[model samples]
Target: MDGIQEFNPFSAGGLDQHNDTTIPISDRSSQPAVLQPSQEPTPKASASAAQVELLRQQEELERKAAELERKEQELHSRGVSMGPENNWPPLPRFFPIKPCFYQDFDEEIPVEHQRVCKMMYYLWMYHCVTLFLNILACLAHFTVDAGHGVDFGLAILWFILFSPAAFICWYRPVYKAFKSDSSFNFFFFFFMFSFQVVVYIIQSVGIPSWGNSGWIYAISVIGTNLAVAVFMMVVAGFFTVSAVLSVILLKMVHGKYRNTGASFQKAQQEFSSGVISNKTFQSAAANAASTAAQSAFQRN
Candidate 1:
């Protein structure tokens, strides 16, 4: 009866004892402990294996995203362009098969084409400068000759009329020339500007006037003017006729190539204006170019 009383099963006993000396180290490490509910992430691995599995999945997703970005960059390198116009690496080269067939038929220009083109460019620039000067001269005449009030008024009027015209005829055309690839447009502008120079000269030389006819509808001046006016007029005539002849010759020389610049400009505009097909122009051009390159390589 005494032994039975000493061995009470419900009492705290050896099973509940926490003596480190009696416990196996591996078993102690493996055992679950009473944990505090935490607001913070576990620093020293209180994490359950299930939580570790979730972190692995997140890492996999980020890795996949980086891989996809790398693949996109690779595809981009193969002459595939994005955004409008598909403008990518590899532009067209000049003299792509050098007019070999036309060598015999193509007439050598009597004048050096490059020199003529450059001269015409210089002439157009001069015409613009001359037109601008003409405006200034009229303004000078107006200030100087107040007694000839009608002449002053007429000069001011001429300045207003010609300033905008000169901008359109010379400034805009020069901008176009720089943008253009056509050999003809280059020379065409050069010849046509002579006319503008002539007009400028006539206006500069004569008394303030109402019309192109130098003698008709002339303004009266009280002051004696310099002979510099006459020199201006002669210069104007030379330029005007030169410009006129240039236009005529250009029309004759490049009747067929009139649409060359127009086509290129239209294509560029269509891309910018959101009217072009995504893969039509640049993609096709790339494909054709690459095919040509491949063929060239194979032959070699």
Candidate 2:
């Protein structure tokens, strides 16, 4: 009987131990469960995603800046003038003609040639003034003697004709040559201006009934009137200076043109174009042909 004895749950120590275990189970059920290490959220993925987004934004901004810069450059290339207007001299309102035929000369003229062009413009102005003064000098002599009337009249005619002619013949051509970088125009201007410089020298020689107050008049008037002689000397000096400067400028222009490959071929091309475009040349050619035909018919 003792060897086969069964365990009793209702006994004092056993029942109390069972009740303690039951209460622990209820208490464990009431408490929150703690998470394992693998279950905890990591901030690494979110942090990496934010970094990538920031980098993408930065790249987009850079791309936009580059695109804007490219657009600005394209605008500039298309003749849209850049830079501040304050950098250039203000245009003169009183002048009958604009400083340059090119609307953007200030921007377009090369840095090397800017001073040269400016000096040329100044010389043109000075030449015009000198011509005007020459006329005045001739009139002054005319007031002294009736025989000087012819000189005064000639001086007036010269001024009226030569001023505009010179602007068209040399000044504009030189401007166009530099502006268009045309070698032909440069050569043409060089030849034309050389002739003009010779004219200046001739005009400077003040003759008795001629318009100029050059060395000739300066020497002739020295004994009679010291003041007139001094004036003639001054005028001759101006003319001499102009001639020298014109020669120097011509040399400089020629050097530049040669460097740009101004050749005989280019000169021929320019000559051909001029001949083709000249109405007077065409008329003369037609007349010559007609005359030749008439002669042939008569001979037959």
Which candidate wins on TM-score?
A: 2
What TM-score number comes out for model 1? 0.31
lDDT of 1 by residue, 42-153 (tens): 7556567667888999999999999988877887987544433421122454634322111111132223233333444445455445445444444444455555456545
Off by over 4 Å in 1: 1-120, 136-144, 147-300
Computed on alpha carbons, the lDDT of every model, listed in order, comes to 0.48, 0.74
Worst 10 residues of 2 by lDDT: 81-90
| lDDT (Cα, tens digit) per residue for candidate 2, span 1-300 | 878957788888778878856755555666568865786457998788899999999999999999989989998889565654432124677755434333345776666666666667777777888778777766666666566688779878878988877877887777767776776778778878989989888877666566676778667767766775676677777777777778778787777676666677877887799898899999999999999999999999
The C-alpha TM-scores of every prediction are 0.31, 0.56
Residue 69, candidate 1: alpha-carbon lDDT? 83
